[model samples]
Target: MSDDTDDAQPPRRLNSLEDRNAVVESALDRAIKRGDFDDLPGRGKPLTGLHGSSDPDWWIKQKLDSEGINGVAPAAFQLRKENAVLEDTVDAFTEESDVRDYLAGFNARVREAVMDLREGPPVFTPPRDVEKEVAAWRRRRNAMKNDSVTEAEPGDPEAEPGYQPVDPESVGSPRRWWHRFRR
Candidate 1:
């Protein structure tokens, strides 16, 4: 009876490519049914940098950007960003001495970074001419002052009597809650 039962069973064939695919698909379906992937981060977000480059490091770069990491940026890139905001930084200071000192420090750092031998994209920023920048800053400040004066003059048809332009710089810096607590 045992020999008859053994002979009655058919031989099992090795799984083919299609059979393996079906097995994987079934396993994925089971996982989905169990809500295994419901809470994953970036679930509906479109993939980034997919078409930007074929570089093998694309995934790593994407991960860094997604995490708001700035330490990974190239030195040249960081310098370029700083250069772009340099004018705003200079304009934020109301004193000529402060502006000159800031520009001098910035130029020195740029020169030092340019002299470094580490391989990266070339720094394209030229050192700022302090005198020329100071002149330009003066011109801008004078123009703003002239505009405010002209707007307030009584001779102008649209002038509001007793209207005075507020100097934004005179406002003291805002204090944070932590500062108040410390005091």
Candidate 2:
């Protein structure tokens, strides 16, 4: 009979931690030789999260930032952002009554949110004064109007007042096919 022992492979025994480590290292080396780790995404880049915060929400924040997601900010943060743009929102209205109504609605919402016992960052935005906001809006609107008027004046010596010169070369002539079709 042929010897079965001669063809049989020996079983590996990890008797200690060092032997286990050596086996793992050998496997890793083989994988490296085979280029198993080459061409990986973010390869050679400094590993992220080393300098980042230890907060558990760090991954969520990073994902949201990388994906350009919005509306994920905390209620307090959202409220602060809304307050920052409140002036612009008020200025959008041309009528005093509309501005008053918008300010009242905004203040009411802020009050409601503040009164709620929900836990979040504290809302720091106080209620806005309608008269003061309206006055500021008027000043802002007048300044914009003045700036536009100044900009529209005939600044170029070659151009007439309120007339902007167009370059004929820049505006190419219609295609011959278009003219033929139109005719």
Candidate 3:
């Protein structure tokens, strides 16, 4: 109708792309609003002037990511399993029960034993195998002494009790003295 003539055909429906994006935005907003969250104290509040930031999910995700600096939960499960294994390993022979029952019984017994100790007296006894204990200690001491291959220099601060020491002067080259001041 006018000289403009519509050769551009009114810029092909960009509404479809915008509408799709808006639908996605609405879904994300709903999901984020529905989630439970704890407020962080002292963290900066969102500024009104900022652009490109979406609502809700960005804040939720930021909070979640910050919280992960404390290590994940499953890693602690290893200690529980190892503790269970150690109970049997440390006592090779004892009265036995199914693993679940044993854990339950041990927990109850340990609780009662702690209460009993608090109340006092299971009558402490001296070791019956003092000679065996002494011999075992001697073997450990001898094994440590035998296994040590290097001798440490007396009064050397860098040397460990069982290890060899190096002279700091030996590690430097007498020739390197000139080179130290260059570049």
Candidate 4:
């Protein structure tokens, strides 16, 4: 006697600004690594919506040709820009004593309201390329365990050059099933 229409799933939760922040960081990282700051001030101009900002290179050249400081021009500009972004991020987070007192603050009340707002949504099974992911993982694990490609004998001059030792940092990862998980 149950209707399937009553089992519809809820819409996904997402924040567009968070996605934009990630993209900006990615592009900024590539630009910084390549020393592509020729577009310095402009690197984040449109991205920051900072008006046709002063050119970073221009400021550097001016400072160098006049003041002889190797790091001041661009560094100073960046300091100002970072200061603004920090101010904006702070402004976005409202002052809330709400979470300070368990039964008092807005944070607790908001959380309660949200829980009430959500009548448990219907669950939906998502079709995923689990087989492909499994194959990829197997290929990776096999590669990690099969790194010896040389026929050289141990400690011989013919021994293969030092192994590019695997980092302990990269040796184990949470994604691997070998990592202990709480049942």
Each candidate: RMSD to true structure? 17.5, 18.2, 19.8, 32.1
Query: TM-score, each model?
Result: 0.44, 0.44, 0.20, 0.16
Local accuracy of candidate 4 as per-residue lDDT tens digits, 76-167: 34333443453233333333322123213323333443445343332122222434434444565456457655356777664557656556
User: What lDDT tens digits, residue by residue, belong to model 3 across residues 32-143?
Assistant: 7976233555337775436876675676556767787542333234334444564344234232334334445445544454455443344222212334433444565566
The TM-score ranking, best first, is 1, 2, 3, 4
How many pairs of residues in model 1 come into backbone collision? 0
**Which sections of candidate 3 miss by over 4 Å?**
1-15, 33-143, 146-183
Compose the digit string of candidate 1's lDDT tens values, residues 1-183. 667887785754537988778778988999999999998999999976667677987778778888988756677777788889887888888999998999998889788879985958888888899999999888888887898776545576458657577779867987677897784
Better of 2 and 4 by TM-score: 2
Tell how far residue 120 is off in model 2, in angstroms.
4.5
Ranked by lDDT, the better of candidates 2 and 3 is 2
Model 2 segments beyond 4 Å from truth?
A: 1-11, 49-64, 67-85, 88-112, 120-135, 144-183
The model with the greatest lDDT is 1
Which candidate, 1 or 2, has the higher lDDT? Answer: 1
Residue-level error in angstroms, candidate 4, position 45: 63
lDDT, residue 16, candidate 1: 98
State the C-alpha lDDT per candidate.
0.82, 0.81, 0.51, 0.48
User: What is candidate 2's lDDT per residue for 1-183, written digit by digit as tens?
Assistant: 579988986979999999999999999999999999999999999998889568988888889999999877555677778889987887788888898898888788678768865857777778788789888888998997887677433566544546567778768865676677784
Candidate 1 regions with alpha-carbon error over 4 angstroms: 1-14, 42-89, 92-98, 113-132, 152-183
